[model samples]
Target chain A: MTEQLVLNYSIAGDDFTKAGEAAADFKTVLKKTGVPPDIIRRAAICMYEGEINMVIHADGGDAEIIIGADKIEIILADRGPGIPDIELAMQEGYTTAPENIRSLGFGAGMGLPNMKRYSDGFDIKSAPGVGTTVKMTIMLPKNRE
Target chain B: MKIREISEILGAEVLCCHELLDTDVHSACGCDLMSDVLAFVKDQSVLLTGLVNLQSIRTADMMDMKCIVFVRGKKPDDAMLNLAVERGIVLLSSPLRMYIACGRLYSAGLAGMSEE
Candidate 1:
């Protein structure tokens, strides 16, 4: 963790078209850094889902990713309305996104679940009136390191 | 199946990356929902969709899909096509609907991951 390469990105709220730009950029960086393909895919998927969630639910947010030799860590903080119930949000088929978002190919309630599915470690903290922060880590296989 | 074969079968026009026509892909999925495409699809190299947006291309990029077939004659904007070229993804537009395109490819031996 001491010699981590840290990258930061600002996510604009309600910008559906630009939602996944940050994650795409991060994936390119990871590819250039010679991360294993599978590891890169997992990190990219998790980050992309997080990016979409930030656009759909939080209006926008910020993402900080630390790339280490053994593990990659992500911290996404959003100023949008916080989730009142993390448990309900994590359910596989539960979503609070509106119909408009659904037509854009999301809001089936799979974002948070898919994020967790791809990451090795996941944490979510939120207060209704306050904002939300999501932390995730994906560990690289030793042989690939 | 090669991307060219998919194109011929679906009567799709190559919008970009024509040089990649020889690329061989084993599986494909047809859906308008990008999130569903992301969550449920695994190792599918071709995407058949009616949705027209940058997100479709972005989802294909994240999944490392080799080709995208825009069913129902949907056309991506210049920005999307530019991004596809940069990412080396083949873009195709077809007059066929999603169901028919998928059926054609499936009958021609392009498989998809089982939901189970």
Candidate 2:
């Protein structure tokens, strides 16, 4: 467990049903590494929220997870239409997700906020037509505390 | 409350992970919005929702929830059930609507999430 562990995943946007697979798999990995339960939960929630956003808004994306001794880092990058206003998008109750996605119990305007809430460090970069990338880090507990 | 008791109170049918019914749950939340459900964090909690999509299961898993009760006779698809089984999350189908189901669980001593 001394070395960094890196995992990459290509998320599919065409299928809404498969949205959370990457997050679920990453959770399993974190559990196997014996990370603290709370830290693992936070990391998984961040990843899951990012994955859902990638599927719903970004069309699809690439997820890169780096597991280190002291922290877990997740980078989700997408090539879909980027957010025009990061401030507004980060607001707790603002969402641009379509009605169809809303019907499926998503697009509550909480995805980004939730991700930021659960992570120790959060950053987002998006351009009007370029794409969006989100980086989140969750600090792991030392001495298993 | 133990999941079994919650099941009994709601008259819910176990959809998956029957063996985990004996697990204890301290708090519960009923919401179709996954993000709202994610705002509160608790140990050994239960999620009661009418949302039957995979995100429901995923949300429960993310928050370390022990069980999910699909209200209003809503049933989860096989994929959702499989994910629940894989995550070791108990799934239940209850005939009661969200409001009544939460009321029944609350009356039965299952508390909601504490304000942070």
Candidate 3:
């Protein structure tokens, strides 16, 4: 617990079926680290939503997770078309994902909002043509120490 | 209620994790949208959805749900079943539609997610 554990994953964008694998893998790792189940669930939800967004909107992305003693940080960065209006994108039920995605049980416009809801710290940086980067941090429970 | 009772109530076929059917689930959520399920659901151990895809399984796994009932006779494909097996999530295919399935479960004492 003294050293930070860093994990990196490359999310494949073309396959919708594989979207949450990274988050699932990370969830296992977190469980093995003895993190509380509630904290693990929150971190898993945040990463899963971010992974879905990267696949649905961005082509693909890199997810970097840093697990420290007091907090878990998730950084998702994608080199795809970025959001034009972060404000609008943050609103619930305001997704731009197409019909196919909705049919697959996503794109309800709750991704970003859900990520923010479960994370203790949330931030996003996007440029219309460049790409987007999202950083979310979940604080571990005080009792974990 | 236990997952076995849920399967019996909905006339659902247990697709995987049959050994876990005796697991108890206190609350449930019925939704087709994974995002909404992830956003609104809290500590709900059962998910009833018509959406048949891998994301449904993944969402349930993320929420730490124990069982997923595919309503409206929807069946999950092999890949999804395999994933559910790995995640230890019980998969059920029910003939009942979304509304009837939810109502039946609620009537059977399975509560929905609490309004927060």
Candidate 4:
């Protein structure tokens, strides 16, 4: 028996302050749905980072979250300058963001790393000049109750 | 240490949550980098940062921080204050800079980031 919920959101560009609103809203829904706190936190962090990435680089993007009985899947698609080097981007402390973003308390190059850290499975698909799509899965420990 | 004590020690202005000033906080983390706070700091009820932005409050809320102290006389604007009020998080600003404010609290027994 499988139960699933899929959520879709459009992350707006140019509003850095409003970036985390979607994740916060999801946390509320997750709480109402009786998901474990740890599992909610993992999904929150992953989506929050992806939200920031969308605003910072792609100017905007689309996010889809599929919640399953055993796992949560997050897919973020952005129409921006695609990642030229996945390996370089994955390296902690390496970022292409400007200093202005750093002043905003981000761009320390931990976004991707943190997403990977909080998620159980991670996948990336991108092509330069076209776009990038990041997929992440976080498994819920069944015995969390 | 309680937030009220921190205010007394530094003579800082309580920008918001005056009623909640007596809330006790066992630990504090001082950092301008929100990512560091997210990645490293945990369970610290109070956060001291020079950065002033809406995201600052959001980050603190995400971490379940109870209070945010803006060091170096940095003041939060209306937007940040509104959000803090909604989240019931105290907001304070002190002219004592990051070092002196942190030291005063440390001497008073509030554990620093690593200790937290």
- Each model's TM-score? 0.96, 0.96, 0.97, 0.91
lDDT of 3 by residue, A1-21 (tens): 667999999999999999999
Winner by lDDT between candidate 3 and candidate 1 = 3
The DockQ score of candidate 2 comes to 0.81
Residue range with the least summed lDDT across 10 consecutive positions in model 1 chain A: A136-145
Predicted candidate 1 versus true structure: per-residue lDDT over A23-119, tens digit per residue? 9999999997768787788899899999999999888999999998789999999988999989999998899899998888889888999899889
Candidate 3 residues lying further than 4 Å off, grouped into runs, are A143-145
Which order, best to worst by lDDT?
Answer: 3, 2, 1, 4
Q: What's model 1's lDDT at B20?
A: 98
Cα shift from native, residue A114, model 1 (Å): 0.3
**How far out, in Å, is residue B43 in model 3?**
1.2
| Interface RMSD of every predicted model, in angstroms | 0.7, 0.9, 0.5, 1.1
**Model 4: per-residue Cα lDDT over B31-103, one tens digit each:** 8988777775356889899999988887787676889999989999999999899888999999998999989
By summed lDDT, the worst window of 10 consecutive residues in model 4 chain A runs over A33-42
Q: Rate the local accuracy (lDDT) of all candidates.
A: 0.90, 0.90, 0.93, 0.86
TM-score of 2: 0.96
| CA deviation > 4 Å runs, candidate 1 | A143-145
Q: List clashing residue pairs in candidate 2.
A: none
